[model samples]
Target: MTTPSTLPAAPGPTPAPAPAAVPAPLPRRRRRAPKAPSALLSRAGVTALLALATLYTLLPLTWLLLSSTKSRADLFGTNGFAPGREMHLAENLEQLITADGGVYLRWILNTVAYAGVGALLAAVFGVAAGYAFDKLAFPGKERLFSLVLLGVMVPGTALAIPLFLLAAEAGLVNTFWSVFLPGLVFPFGVYLARVFSASHVPDEVLEAARMDGASEFRAFRTIAFPMLAPGFVTIFLFQFTQIWNSFFLPLVMLSDQDLYPVNLGLYVWYSSALSQGHPEDYLLAVVGSLVAVAPLIAVFLMLQRFWKSGMTAGAVK
Candidate 1:
């Protein structure tokens, strides 16, 4: 050990006791100033977009409110949103009622009858068809459902000619039945019913009822119907709105103005206003438009509970 030979002299001086490894200056974390658009600006951008949308929707409603106050001359002559000297809404309504043996009221009654009866029948048929498709093991179930889905893609406008022809063959053209019959054949309603039944009516439930010796129809009526109630209301509301706002079908089928729904009736007024030089009918069209929307609003408010409940049920298992 004492005789351990000295190592040959190295070319470079021995490095001083290896300095503790420093972490390569840790890439100087240049304390960057906050990004130009901070979180507050991002939130503000979204709020501004929503505000613009709200203003766009309400702007026309605001104009309608102001327009309702003006007389016929003021409607076209005055600035659109400016209030006029005469508040003629009451006078206009009175005239509207007295016209043609108060045919507008008859139109209103016919609309209610058509929408109510048609929507009820639609709901019933849709529910039955949906229940059968969802619960029953029938031939061509998927194929039939695909057909129904395809029906949704067929524009109602395109079917008007064929429907008119069928109604003509049955001698039902221009009758309330023409409208009612078509409304009852709602493929969309059937689709919705199928979705609701599949989601809400568990097979376990039907099996349990079957085990208890309950008839199939009895099981569905007593057990499945309750769960389907929320879905039914939603379907009813959707169908009702469809029938209520329907213009093209009634326009083609029913020649009688009194049989017209509000939408069709208003359209007639709009057509008349266009041909006739009188602008009074223009005001009527606008006011009638507002009134037509009111029932839909009321229905939505009344049935929003079902809609909300249905959405919740749809999301839950």
Candidate 2:
């Protein structure tokens, strides 16, 4: 009987919460400026220096070429770069060959034989010594190599007198053997051989060869010598140049004009020019100088591959 109806409560509007404070976004970072082309300046400077050095070296050569083209009268009168009215190069070359009963040709042949054979022999001996020093273990190896280093330090010029005496004792003075014998024992060649062998011929490879029943000499001849051929060329070329351009030893050893190398022969011409008051010899001297450099150039051009390969092989492990 007590039924009562409950009434719903009336809704009221609520106040909005105060707006939360908004924070400002941080500024975007600016990227750093790229580096300036400072490297280009360094490269430019190096290029300029190299160019200047090249010019310095080539300027004299140019002068020599132009001067060689001139006649005796034009040589003194004409500016160094100016071409002379008379191109006497052909005449000068003819005169060089025919002059002094063609002694210059003899000098040329003598030089070739001495430099070619001596350098070839030196390479063989040097490589053998170097290989032995690098690969073989023996008593006095270090001591012997040290002695070799000492020999390298001794000036070739200083040894000239002693060499002269030795030649006199052997009665080899005024002979090709005097020059050839001394040129065979290049201390630096041995040094380079040791260096190259240490780098190129791995001990492990030699060990493997030995384990495979290869004798030490057999392993060297079959395996190591082939690897060392590039070094051989290097030593050969070096000794060749040394022997070709050698003046002092020849000067001391040979009294015979026919036995002189290009260097000593040119020196003879130079001295005769001064003494005889013949400036024509001056032109011959220049022409001979140019001719002397040709073979070396040819050698480098022909064997450039071996040299470059040897160097690259050396740098690798």
Global lDDT scores for all candidate models: 0.84, 0.88
Candidate 1 off by > 4 Å: 1-41, 314-317
Best by TM-score: 2
Each candidate's TM vs. the true structure?
0.83, 0.84
- In model 2, what is the error at residue 37, expressed in angstroms? 9.7
lDDT of 1 by residue, 109-171 (tens): 888888888998888888888888999998899999999999988988899889999999999
Q: Which candidate number maximizes lDDT?
A: 2
Candidate 2 residue pairs in backbone clash: none
